[model samples]
Target: MPKTALLTDLQRLVRAYGVLAGTCDHERAIVGPISREWIASEVEQSVLLSSLPAELFDTQRGKDLLAAELYSDRNVDPRSIDPDTLDLSELCRDRVINSNRIPKLEPQINCAVLVANMLLGVRLYGNHGAGVPEISHDLIVAAMLQDALEKPYVFSALSSAEYEIVDADYIKTWFGPNVAMLSYQIRDALLAFETSSDSVVSSARIANSLAAIFASRLRLTARAAGDSVVSFLGTVRRAEVVKKGLDPDSSFPERPYLARDFELAEAALQLAGVDHYALREPVENTLMIAVKDALEDETKRSRLSGRRGKAVHELHINLPVMEYYVASESSNSLETVHLASFEMMRSLEKGRRKSLSTMVAHAFRISAFAERVLGDALEPLVITLAMLHDVVEDGSAAVTGFDHSLQKIMFRFGAPIAAMVSELTDSSVKTAGAHKARMTYEQPHLISPEDQYNVNRFTELDLRPSDGRQPYTLSGIVIKLLDTVVSLEEGIRDPELMTDWWRHSGARIFWADNMRGSIVHPLIERLVIELKQSRSDPEYALKPHRVNRGRLRAGRALLETTLNHLDMYTTQNLAILSDEYQLDESQREFLIRSFNDPNITEERFSKLVLDELLTEDRLCRAMDLGRVPAKNYVTLYKKSSVPEESSDKTTLLSYRGNALRRKAIRTELGLDTPEGITALSLRHEQVLSMYDQKMSSTELKLPCDTVEMVS
Candidate 1:
């Protein structure tokens, strides 16, 4: 609602137009309050509308004897209030900021909303009138891309479609399907290479790989600045991480680095509007050789190769890297961006090194740390996938082509990393709108959980053979969730907003929208939220779990995120059955004779599997008593919160439903988990064994619980 000041301003403007008296007459006479209620209503509205909040309204406070405040014995003080300054007509209309529904849509869906907004708000919903441009395919595509890239800024600052309409005109039509003209641009870029190291890529073949993919994305995102692109690529080349002649050096200038770079430039032009396939090898190989020969590596040439695949992706911006660099004049804004990003990643600062040689080393270390943590709760290959999650964003990518950056990251890590990188690098994930990105990312196909578990998803991007028996495994499910958790933990700002965005999109797959209503949320949401808050804002001081600020309370706050009882039951119940059925050392001797019979269900085998996770007996009862120990500190407490004791607690009795979760979990672990799921558990030797074999989710879980013997 507009503040009373806004309404007052509107009315003041009306009065300035000599309509105040006229409006007053119209209100008192023809539109006169017919009933006592009507008169009372308008009078009360006049009074309430007069009071505006602080963010709005400036000076001058008086009714000026314009509209008299009438009281209706109707108790006006603590009730509904009317907007004073704004016109009643505009009051009911939705504000542009909150009017749109892009948050609820996927990339395809929200693009329509953006287009519509441009058509309406830009075209006719503006002060000047008819600002909308003629709709064209190129216009749609560019607008869609712009929506993805600048959506956060747009939603935050500009609301009128006209703002985008104005910006769209400057989208630089230099590189699209129109190629004949881009030849000049290419020639211009090639010219930059002629003079120095800019022309030649330095180092092992990886340089060539970086150059190749970068050229590809560059050609696709022709808007990239040639100079910035050169600098960024040059940065990678100068790092000297690879071996051989491919390294960057003064001798083999960037310009003469093989005919393939020029060829790739052409290929990029051909593949414009061709959704995927960002990187191809033959072209990459040529570029690698050229860049390699240009290198000045003091050491032996690297055995590492450039990323290999037919996968293509696109990225463009106002930086100096691509053909058209966008140097927004406000140098201050750029610093703010850097500052924000730096602050958001402060969680990683603790592990950083003081020396120069160890920066990348530190990154690898953190990656290893995340890997180890997830490994404990999940399978091994999946941990690698998680590590590769941030490799692309780490600044090594030169963006030579579509998905060039991601390809470079994959290449840097090798095949296993490449596979996981493939799954994590979705064009859908890089949305202009934060919520749009969330929607696409949360899609069942794109990602499983929140971004908090990014490393979890990275390892599982590719396929490994599934175990023949059961559908899914906990490791598989956890990876997806882990991927989500990592993303959310790092980039997301508002937890409430994050949850809302998740609900809007994740609802289809997750069913229960709010975290408080789910099993997983109760188990993990607090940690994620605390981590996110602590990292996002400097003021938020996060403490280890045992050190929570307050003492235990009655009906205390549990977890902001809670999974549904049914889902929890299914996952826990199945795990319990597997636990009891798989490991019976006493039955080992009998197993030789009973080899003819398969593993029996717990109920049929004279053993009952009770879930340690569920609260029925001692442990659960203690937990119910609010005397559970904190996860990080192991400190015990009581009376955490005495809920008014609602009838909400349900005993896990005769009920079952995990067919879908199991299906998704298994599919993810076998195919998506990196290195493939041969085994499950945190034990090092066992983990190494699992990494070597491709086991079905059931086979992995079989030994995990049901089968305890060697032969």
Candidate 2:
């Protein structure tokens, strides 16, 4: 057979050996305390033995000799065995038969035996050095026995007097000084790789460690970032080692090798391919490339290649050289987040209005917050949902294409994930309203009808049940709150977007209310403070004075109507004021005074209510009253605390109130002259000119009024 065909067959055998070993380990754990005879019988009946090629074994006499040597004693002394005289197939059979005899030492024993077999096979067919400058009988024996020599206690723990500690002296006596020295080097390299805090290490140590870990996880489970390091370790030549005069016991030189061993190891993974995205840490693109190269299916290989190319384009990353850089930069661990990020970039890449970088940052922030809140309970699910919350809504139709995209997601991922994405996606007003209704149902006393109307648009789902029951899962609601918090944070960072942010402030209130008793309440409280700071900034206030004034006027009208409808201010109404409205004692007192004052003008009373009494929290509370039953019974009366005041005192109070009202109006009209009259006049003229230009540029039809002339 060709060397390539031989190596391919060896890779297949090694993978089968790994899976068989892993199955034995699992069975030992579950079945409990079986005898070594049973383990040997189980190995004899397994497919691993049946699949061994006849060419690997010697003649029948050689097999009889090997069987007699192995079956003579349960524990074979290492020093008595000669590597040159042993047949490869017989040795593999002996290892497989005795692999699970020691329950506590099974994994390590299996790992060592499999790795040694892999190295020997790669050396024979792939023409690669195992780890040393050349392949030899002693090298093969040392690779197989390295783990036993390193951990002598495990071998001693076998049946009484069955095995002894296989130490360095025993190895040297059996395989000579060169194999003993090589085994020591392998052990030291493994220790350095596993124990060293420094990430940068010699390529030889990395290769050895990768082989060891890969052998250990033969079940093809997900690997961590540190363990998934797949780099090319070129073959070490005897001439190069001799020319360098390198110490045999020290670290190997930093240089490229033939990489035949790495190729063999990758081929061993062809059956159960690596899930590059399913790993818990961000894996390098080399890992993905390695998996792709190992795959025999052309379609799978091309599909993976195409997706990577698309990701490279969408992320605007230069491929080939910078793929590892991009992979290292990603903090997301879940495969869904990675896909969602790519989809988001693809959808938003055309307009580039919203920064893709910012969106990525938001996704990370939301996922992190969700992970923290959900903890280990629903961490994976919550983070996946949170990261994908905006993909369908914000995605461009031409790119993601709505239903087609969702169907693809469903097919690629599972149905539960696609369903959650659907729940999170606000694809239509009806869906948005359903989300609003769900949130409103969580806390009926906290959300306003206007917010419900604005969010839902229809009156059908507006009514909150009298029982205040929430019927939805917590994951969707938690993601909504987290998404809102991240958005509000973005708005807070950029002052220009604050105006647009406040337009959705009602939704924020609703979110906070719904999350009142949940784990995300603290986040809501923090966001509330941030919102106040942004709202109260004098600069922000000045930027949108007209819009602010209009909102204030509308609020004042609602407050007056609410006050007029109150028949009596019962204790229940007071409780509602304190709990739902969140009004302080002083604001409530002032509101009562302003409502009952017969002498105060309606306009002045409304101004007092707007400026002194009704804060945003109180306004949200007042908005909720239209749905609450307590609002229909509340009444206003003159406070007994208001004593008869002298005319001079009353006049002084009147003057102060008038001045305060005048200043409020000036601030609302942007006439306080912060930058002096000249700049203000220039700004006013610029605004009027822009308005006139806009009006004259567009043709408008005006209504003509005809009046009969009296003359």
Candidate 3:
């Protein structure tokens, strides 16, 4: 799918009108990426009296057909209506003549398409089992027209009397009463749909299905700025995840809460002029299961490749609707990433680095971090890089093999992604023996667990930064920084555990040192220098914009919070697990003596002895007490009125209310706590009061003392 195909004439026309009238950004996100084929097909088969073309709007016959389509009742004078009133000349003139408040045209187009398609989808597919109403094509045409007609009224460009002259009733008098009525209904529905939080699953499913069909029809490739096509696609994907009973939240990058499947489905159904119960269970069941299966199994679709003799899978916007059926597994964008990720997993299996699952997690987190900072526009590329970042180095891919991977990436995705991934692989990690080879097993030790701990803590390993390094491209730097952040986040979880886990390499250097040993060392150094300079150097500082600063700050905060929670959890686990086993005095003495002997150290010993000592009785008793993070801190608690107040007259009334208020205290902590919030409030109170008496000694006749109060 090429990017150009998604931008159709219908989209342009709709957007132009939307810009002139002004539509909300969220509404635009929903309204963009409508399928021209689907709309035309619906218009062709609709209960419409005629399918008027752009040119036909100029003819009397065209006006008659349009007027007929608009009004089912058909009580109107068509001859009195001038089709010229439907023309966009005034809107264009306004854009040309005016200097302020002009909306970006492309975004408007995308918004218009989304809204128009969604409206039609709701009308057609959102059946309440009363069967779809005799929906008129006027709804489709009126989508764009209504926005234009309402523009003057919306922007206050026309006065009340002037608006009345071209109001619904007036226009209907010239056009037709039915047309006017239908237009009002559509306009109202649009508003209701945008604002309402009601659930209507059938309508959402249908709307998503319609958008999927449109995406497939247009083969939408490139992301359009200010359009919700990318996000809409993501929403559909999330819906699929929900339909499959998967958690929609991304743990790697962390996402704010999203609505559940039932909620989303219900919302869609409501917007589509249908009730939830009206939807057939059989249809819903099939949509949930079979449609997804069909989407996953289908594999015949093809897409354009940047290289000759190489075609990739077409972008799949999977919908279970008969019209949306694509018989290719690779038809959708989700499938493409899934396939790539699967391949990456398999590659890691051959030469596993930090376990296949952990590596995959890293990839997901990296991609997620990228998406957070860069926005959705670069998500696909960023994710692809994350997936393949370690393949070449960790998988021990040959030069020729890497070249092939690069070629495959270029042909399948694009060059930009291939370039980024190429830069992500730290080739130095593979060439030098900074880290142990995958095949080389660690030497078994005769040390006791305590001795092993001592060795892990005291032994200094020869870890050094790679001297051979080069500069980094901006794209490469972005990915590496994200990679470093994610890696550190994981490594920070019990730094001791990490050191123990990689004990073979000694505890002196861990992730940071390991990174320094790789090709990314110089890049990290450069980044550090830049960051330090950025604090004081105006030229080196981040772009002077809230958006840029906010993204960086927010991303950092989220990463830190997540990292802290994970670290706390792991530390608790370690504390409990460590107490599970203990050596008796005599056994400990013998083991320590044996471990001290260099000859005995050469003999392999088993840590299994300690594991066996941790019987169920001991483990169960330890667990009975529970393990929780320490929470010995003070926090102010407030009450409107304490039933039993302390024996003190320091209480104060709340400013706005007459209710008595006082500070209280509470303390508690829990393990496995998923979520919560704590509030902090500040107050000032007098610590002490004093009374002082002053006497002027110089005044001979005055033995008077003056009293003063201090607060």
Candidate 4:
């Protein structure tokens, strides 16, 4: 038979078996106990003849192939033959006959049949037709018997039965060139599935699965390493249950695990030598249907429903909410980004207290902003960094020290993530020294000598570079911008923090201006407008007490003088400026000038600094921001308008409820103006974009159903 015809016949046979087994209790029972090997053979001649279309099996050659006894006795009833009860020699008899070679002891036959089936499935379903040779029975039979000649010791260890090892020459001499040539390919798929299965069953190997999964997902190279990425994910799921102080063997009600299965299936398929990218849409569609059915069943059982609300009320860190947030925010992000979000959340759970929700929200907001602004071209690097940007900096040093945390990130995630995080972390003693000197000069009473010593020691950890701070990568700069934007938003939403937020915003805006002409420039432009608008709001005006006003004026004066006199905006230069202005005649002159000026109102100073002093080209040169290469910046501004109302009533209701809550909060904060409403609407649109991306990516619609269930 031709290759296509043969594959079509085989696929029909498997599909027919699936349908028949679903309806027939006896067939189902027989399939339930045996391994995948016996199940492959379970597409018996009778099932083929009865279940498949008559035209498919009408040919005598097809019937002959299906009805061939091969090494097994044709007269025997398959229903009566118990695979578990069969002798090892009896299992090896087929391999012996197929290979036409006899070793001193029989080689193991554990994965031979399953590996053959998997290879055949890959040929049938994968996109290997253009350059691949035609399939033949010799190749199929070789695949089936390949495992018996290779991996003899592995099988012996697995089954606790002695087996003689066979060499490549034996395979070539006994089974011909096909088996010898294809044995390695068979071994790759075999070991991938085998190791994955082993990880699922063996307690000793469970801890290593997370690292394996992380490496596989990051590099897409775990297939050759004998690790099934999907299986590791499953093992990690169970491990998470254990971490939650629950029994690993017990059932856990969660949808993220199911969603992750769908999400990671493509990676698994790719590892198994399937052309997952080419088949992604169809494969995801099929898996989505299966998952939706599973979700319906879980919903009927009340397993997925109502749990989020209960968990929210009872748990400090509502995992379902967190998972939903991360999934939605990372829906359009890369696999690495998605994985990093989970890792960051796991790390945060160890050290964070009441600030857990705030931190998580902030991280996810940064991730969301990354996807919206940068798109997916640089998503893997930028989004991963965005998610983990604060793991070392914000985590409690007692729970996980800075080095330990950073090394763990490097080990689990990769060096690039750790490096970017280190760059982003404010861990340099040099930076601390600069901050300390500036603070001492600006407000000497605030930092006692002991506090200054602590700051110095904190910076001495050397988590970052030793010589000086390395310039930020374009990704690091984008993360910093997003972080600032999120902080500014938080400040805008909370009236009590307005004055402090304004001060911080001023510094950050200057930092942003110094980064003009980079990919983050557009974002900076938007931020400047928002800051200007927010600063103009009389409700959120800087109305500090007299003492704080004096301090603010002095700080502004110090900042302006430093910017005016400094040649380059490096930390070294800033430190020198602070020292010189503190000790020299310039110190008294600066203090006198700052206190003497009455026209430098907060608004006028901001206008002068933002509009006059810090033009784009000037600060860009002063800071040498263009030293780092710039990438094309993308924006979703047009896409940020409110999305069309979802056809899903449940989702629409949830969106409206969310909008109402946001409106209520803004109203309470006295920020319910037209611009505020428009900004919130844009945010609402951004969330819907994430929601849509997540729905498409996972191909699972649990969110709409989840909302209905929670309600």
Task: Give the top-scoring candidate (TM-score).
Answer: 3
| Cα RMSD (angstroms) for every candidate in the order listed | 29.8, 32.1, 30.5, 29.5
**Per-residue lDDT of candidate 4, residues 164-192 (tens digit):** 34456645543455545655454454455
Tens digit per residue, CA lDDT, model 3, 384-495: 4566676555544231111235444444434444444555555455543222211111212111112211223222322122111323344444555566655544433212
RMSD of 1: 29.8
Model 1 has a clash total of 105
**The CA-based lDDT of model 3 is what?**
0.31
lDDT of 1: 0.25
Highest lDDT: which candidate? 2
| lDDT score, candidate 2, position 409 | 44
The window of 10 residues in a row where model 2 has the poorest summed lDDT is 702-711
Candidate 3 local Cα displacement, residue 585, angstroms: 18
For model 1, state the Cα shift of residue 340 in Å. Answer: 31
TM-score of each: 0.21, 0.28, 0.29, 0.26
- lDDT tens digits, residue span 108-217, model 2: 22344334433333333232212233434444444544445533231122122343444677555434566567667666654654454233334432343345334333
Better of 1 and 3 by lDDT: 3
Stretches of candidate 4 exceeding 4 Å from the true structure: 1-333, 350-356, 376-378, 399-403, 428-467, 495-711
| Predicted structure 4: lDDT | 0.32
Q: Give me candidate 3's TM-score against the actual structure.
A: 0.29
